[model samples]
Target: MKKPFNSKLFFFILATLFGVILSLPTFLQTQGPKIILGLDLQGGLNLLLGVKSEEAIKVRYATLASALNHYSIEEQILLDKLVVGEDNLSFELLDSNEKSKIDKYLSQQEGLEIVEKDLQYTLALSANEKINLENFAIEQAIGNIRNRLDQFGLSEPSVIKQGSDTILVQLPGIKTQEEEQRALDLISKGGHLQMMAVDEARNARVATMSEREAQSYGDVILPFINNPQQTILLKAIPILDGSMLTDARAAYDNNGQPIINFTLNSQGGKIFADFSGKNVGNRMAVVLDGKVYSAPVIRERIGGGSGQISGGFSVSEASDIAIALRSGALPAPIFLLEKRSVGPSLGADSIRASLIALISGAVLVILFMVFYYGIAGVIANLAMVVNILLVVAVMALFGATLTLPGMAGIILTVGMAVDANVIINERIREGFRAGENFIKSMENGYMNASRAIFDSNLTSLIAAVLLYVFGTGAIKGFAITMSIGIIASVITAIVGTHGIFRFLQNSIMKSGNYALWFGYKQQVYKRKL
Candidate 1:
């Protein structure tokens, strides 16, 4: 003697209504969390980039050389020979007294193999260390590229490792050439900011000095960013690098030109203060990737960990640089192995095809359920619709991307959504033939069908989880949609349908018509002598 619609049904209806509300913004293209179309579903740039991981080893070697050179100058240790080899650097100590200092420096280093014959020492990376560095370079490149894309305000850009030495990048909504070029530059920007002293004693003769002569004097000739024809000679060793940068932003200067303002971490702040305090009246060149942006004379101590780079950049260029700096430098340079731009028209065609397939599949499933199960089939169809809505609503709530493969997953789920109800309906039909009451029949039906539904959905969920964990790009998208769809189907087809049947149970029992309610004829008993 319960109400026609019980509290269970009320809660079920509320959940469906909540799903509808959550999905509305996405379907209507309004604000709030919405599903993003993937590269195949929307026009975008697809790139296969090869990371030059080998260059990482060279960079490490060069870094060691720089550190050694800087230490020699700081400690005033004379050296007879200082040469950077292809795999290592070799230097001979001219003063025997400095051997202890050099040995201590070598001890503090992390990964290096050193050989000494009298005063000359050779240093190189161990085989395992080199291999590890190369592998780390690839991972670091992927992380940096993803971080840059995320900060560039691009929507759901895909950056994944394709293989041991390559990356696959999918940037959605990059239609124009300008956008593509900007994205390319942003991803490739090394962001190797260095602050080097402008070798004041020899800078005056930079125009006439040869490259070899500058190297002999521990200086490097770098071109100016604004005018590449002009060059400045800076000390080879950098006083500071971008490794310490905590944040960077594009801002306008007093002259209305765009500039990059940056902040540094605690260690960098202390170094900046000490250097500026001591180097007053000396120029310090702001170098980035072998190009000097500015060389301003340090007039007084600069503190607070803040600095600016002024290079006459446009707003867009400045913004890109700022984003790159904030995202950190790539461990190695990446070259484009392949580039493909997906056209919007192609995406339109794909979307149309996918929609046609999904709708067609769902319609056929809905019709089959209605035809076979009759009134009970109608309830199952209702559950299928609610299941689909919940899947979409949850994906939109999470801002997940929708790809073509993902659409295919939803289509597959549509056909599978009513499976639980199919089992339950058959069980109840069997009960009706065995002379069971309407309420007891449904209760037995659900109880018997529960295990099958649980086992099937549980196995499917496990597969989806594995697919998500090990699969890449499109496979991951497919896995996500299928996972969501399966969970929603369990809720709608199993739990929701049971509640709905309970809500309609009293009417069916009072009507005493199993044929209309369950699409089956009831057996009539005749008295016999």
Candidate 2:
């Protein structure tokens, strides 16, 4: 009755081989595990950023005021004392008759409500408009930060919104303080780059004008990044901005110094070509966050929309700038509310402690199983080892990240695996007391014990799924490992251990030995026919 080729045995062998192959890279120390380690385990930066929502509101009003200025010039309306407030823009009409005209202009605008009181006209966003604007700003900030991180080349970063105006960032495996700061700078920089024409006449006249007097001319004087003492006068209206950029990268200049090379979209390309073609000799300032990085003269019409920003930058600085530029600007400024860096040495210590706990737990479990059930216990111990290997291999295959909590999950799985063997071995002892033959007793034990095993693991799997859905960071890591471990345990307990018992049964039958290895005395009792 011995079968030469058993499907269950074949499956068990194949799965073990697959698990070994999947885990070989990590075992050999040739390469790291396919599963990544989280920030807590690997050591990196954790940042909490609060978005300046008021800044977004201010920028919105500034843009509206610029539009209103254009309308006033075009319509030839004389308005006085224009004021920009936190939520509204107000102006007084010199003539009351112009109220109707202003009302008509405001009615045409979307998301704006016009109000008139005491000859003062106020334009403000409606309630829905305010909510929409705030949400849009937050969503835009998230998108911009994700793009920046992607370009910065960090793998498996967690960039998520913590609350209405807060963002949580966790970057794993960053080792140096300089690198961490560089990443923080790249994420928070607004990166509002602009190309503006230099105003030579105003530049000369601004030397005599007071700061307040110079502001009335609607021109901005910004210091150069390389030489802060030297300043340039640029028109407030930009000829081009970062919004039109399509790509940017870091490159070396002719002198081997680092610079950022950028390209524009088709429309921006045509605009630059037209502007540079007409003003070939004038200097166009490359401004970023109100600081002029460079002001190069137009030698010829730069038709390709390609340009470089060079200002004595190191390689890493230039690379950061290029990444920020390519990712676009944040909708609003982000202030760091809290920052914590985990040192790699601490992470190493943690790993050491977790490994010690795991090895000690596994050794104790293996010894107990072997001492309790004799040969059957040894089979279960073997299955437990395979269970752990398969769990790790599954994690590697799925590219899951492991954390301290995840290591705890694995240890818990070892106990769960032993639980399965205990159930089956106890059922086998009961069947032996009922006077069943070796093969029949083993068959009944596996059949009767599998139902309880399936039900318990099923409920645990459901809980793991819920945890994964609702948890964050390390909790999620725990859920993922626990989930994978549960599945691997079921396979190893039912299929792997059973296959070994089947092989043992065949060998015992051939040797004419009907000894029970269930660690219990057999009783001569009548079978319930």
Candidate 3:
């Protein structure tokens, strides 16, 4: 007789069929959504870095000095000297008449302390503002590092804070030394950009003058990036800096040499236009991290806030620098505290060991279930198999990363999935011992088992969610797989196995073979109320 249309059975078959199809990419390397192996499962680079928040404050001070210098030039304020002190700035105003103009500008700025004594003005960052800036720098650095790694097309890169001032980074598929070095360079690149005018009058003495002597003349000495042996002198104050930069990308120059094309925001554009328009026939140095990359003479007024950096770069170098610039400069320098690399062989061994443990446990569970419960155990084995498949299928569909800890979660899931079936089987055997018929015994078995299964699964899912929220990297991976497994087990164990019992209810009843199906001897038990 045809079994009446059963929704539970239909859903079981539908879910099983979909799991197989959706998991094909992960199982067979087909063209579809697939799970990605993380750092522990695939070779990669790991780094621990400490952010120098103090240096960030210094960078902030230098930027402020540049702004003040630009303000002086814009307002035609003469200054005998403008110096950026370690924690404060001191400048001597040549004209006391324009002091009111400078005072108005300072008043408009926030988080600053200013004082005036005769022709001298002092400016410093407030104590509370200093702490805030330091904290902001660390947070900003983390964001910039993550952004740069994402642009590299890496799969599942991990970037997170470890402590108050430290960052942890993991990259999944860096196999060769070259790839590792490239990533390290990109991560550690300061990316500080500045546009300073060449000190034309004193630049001729750059090759002969000491840094101290150069600074005394209100000039700074820097080496060309393409030729470090060739030193140049530049004005201490910048015409503009990267704070106004909006976009940068790797491109080729006329000679097909690699270069980085950059675009600036409106403020920077006007500054570039104003500086170039007024300083025609003079040279401006394009400096990055205090090293001059290029010094080009201003031919005419350059507009549109666009410029390019040419340093005789290779394609990869240019691309990396472009990514750094595009992501915005790191607020502070990060020092590498530790470096470690995991090899492919180690990853392979981990995979092999995890598989061995998983297969061994599953096989033992299958054997025990079949031996103890006979045919009823076979029904559970079917649900158990589908449960495992569904777990992998869901993870593949979501493109989740699988780490070693995640493999352990799956192994634990195998045991948990079978535990539910075991409860149902034991409940049915108890029903038989109590003199119940086949159909009624099966109904009582599921009814008793479902509550216990639901409660356990719900508690486990809650724990998994908490782990995901508070844990980082590998812990999160484990929680993710464990959570998916819990949901899959509920569907295949309680719902799927119950559907199977309903579908075969008639066949077993006609045979009257309780002993063979359930490992129980009803003939030995007395009928009771």
**Cα deviation in Å at residue 128, candidate 1?**
1.4
The TM-scores of all predictions, comma-separated, are 0.94, 0.82, 0.90
Candidate 3's residue-wise lDDT over 137-220, tens digit each? Answer: 889999999999999888889999998989999999999999999999999998889999999998887889997887777788
Which 10-residue span in candidate 3 carries the lowest summed lDDT?
520-529
Could you give the candidate ranking by lDDT, starting with the highest?
Answer: 3, 1, 2
- For all candidates, what are the clash counts? 0, 0, 0
The models' CA-based lDDT, in order, is: 0.87, 0.80, 0.89
- Candidate 3's C-alpha runs over 4 A off are 1-3, 71-80, 93-104, 428-448, 520-529
Spell out the clash pairs found in candidate 1. none
**After best superposition, candidate 3 residue 358: deviation in angstroms?**
0.4
Please, what are the lDDT tens digits per residue for candidate 1 over residues 203-273?
88999999999888767899999899899998776777888899999999999999999999997787788
What's the CA error at residue 39 for candidate 3, in Å? 2.4
Instruction: Please state every model's RMSD to the true fold in angstroms.
Output: 2.8, 4.7, 3.0
Name every residue pair that clashes in candidate 2: none
